[model samples]
Target: MANSSQKKIAHENTKILLALRKGFIWVNAFYIFYRIIYQWNTFELKLALGYLVSAGISILLYTQINTMGKPRYNSKGELADAGEDLTQEGLVQYAFDIIYVTWFVHVTSAFWPKMWWFYLSIPLYAGWKVWQLVVKPMLSRSGAGAASDAASESTEGTKSRRREKMENRAEKGPQVRYR
Candidate 1:
């Protein structure tokens, strides 16, 4: 009963987490698009770029931390040696930290702000995360990303070998007779 309840909690938490992630991505994308369209010629590249750079650095740090020092896969799709853990407990609790700081800065910039630039960092950061999570994974699956081509070839070779072995066994017929 306890195990069952634990599973239920985990399931609910996973659903909530997924919903939040999707909402964040969509909201950021739409917000960025609206701002870009609304600003058009009035866009402030300096502020946008600055915000983006700061957010990008935070994202990079967060990514490195979240990996928990796991070895990156090699060109053959094999895990490399274990590396040192860069962040303890994925510390810094990245998302809230970034949101709080950026939000504060954005609100304060109001006196001299290009409204679009203030919020631009979010979409840029979200877009990068999306690219990493979605686009890059798709590319790798399609054998387009780094190491994917070699990995796919190896996978194909493995499948063919498996098929041939199965076929060879089939030719020998069943060793046991069924009643």
Candidate 2:
């Protein structure tokens, strides 16, 4: 039952990640198109190349994520045991990050002369989004909790109780009743 619940949670995470990736790709593509249209006359080579590369990378990542195989589990039948796989979701995440940064640079460069501070401040918003969506979830799943260790220690009592309960169950052995 615990394994199934974990599996369900992993499945949900995968679905959410996939959806976020696809949504970001669509938004990136649209922004690139809009940039190209907006700068049709100006034609800044650096900005153009940035947009083109970002779009290409995003599309490739999307394809890879869609084609990547489902994650494997461990002896305990937990997806967390799988650690990290690189073929799909990981690559998509990396690609989307690149896309975001590239867009940030392009936009800032394009508007810097007219609105320097505003353009420079744009990345703060981008940084917040990246932290919330990408960094938080990835780190939480990876068990990188050194920063939160103190906070977690506050729950030591609850943890001890749960551990004690599990040990008691083991001592009692499996409750099996044959029909």
Candidate 3:
């Protein structure tokens, strides 16, 4: 029974994880594409293309490493046996945040004084999303005099509460036996 519930939750996480991955990839791709087009009139075509190429290659490499190689899981789940994999994934995102913000700040501050806030948006938005996902757990683990129960952001798909409907179906695959 317990195993069934776990498998259901894993499946749910898989769906949300896939959707979030797709959204992030698309957002970054659009940013790179827009930057190249936006700079075409001012910067030399080669310079713009160079930026586009670099961003494109980085995205490709990220996808390859994340999908083809073993995936590093997030802290939200019991998916990784020892939690090491989850921590490594967080570290990778932290490094990415540093690299992205530094690069954006450097270039935007010098070339496009009109859009400095854009440089900050990438890092700030990422940080906000991380806070949503991790802040509760971090607080709970800190353990001061007043205790707060940890709450994780549950994606709509996560089936943590297995209904009696599911329990019966698990024993016999969904052919409904009403007593």
Tens digits of per-residue lDDT for model 3, 1-179: 54554455455545544654675566555545555555445655555454565456446545543453233345895444211131235555654554455455435533564454564576687789778779966776687424422332333345455655577779887575689
lDDT of 2: 0.59
Q: Write the per-residue lDDT of candidate 1 for residues 16-88, one digit (tens) a residue.
A: 4445445445544543564445555654787667557655754565454334344445699644433443222
Q: Where does the lowest 10-residue lDDT sum fall in candidate 3?
A: 79-88
Two-way TM-score contest, 2 vs 3, winner: 2
Tens-place lDDT per residue, model 2, 56-173, is 7656665565445345666796575322333345545665565555556555545452322343444686698799999999989667676568667877556677878999999999
Best-fitting candidate, scored by lDDT: 2
lDDT of 3 at 78: 48
C-alpha TM-scores of all predictions: 0.35, 0.37, 0.32
Off by over 4 Å in 1: 54-94, 100-179
- What is the TM-score of candidate 3? 0.32
Q: How many clashes show up per model? A: 0, 0, 0
Candidates' lDDT values, in order? 0.54, 0.59, 0.51
Candidate 1: deviation at residue 65, Å?
9.5
Report how far off residue 149 is in candidate 3 (Å).
52
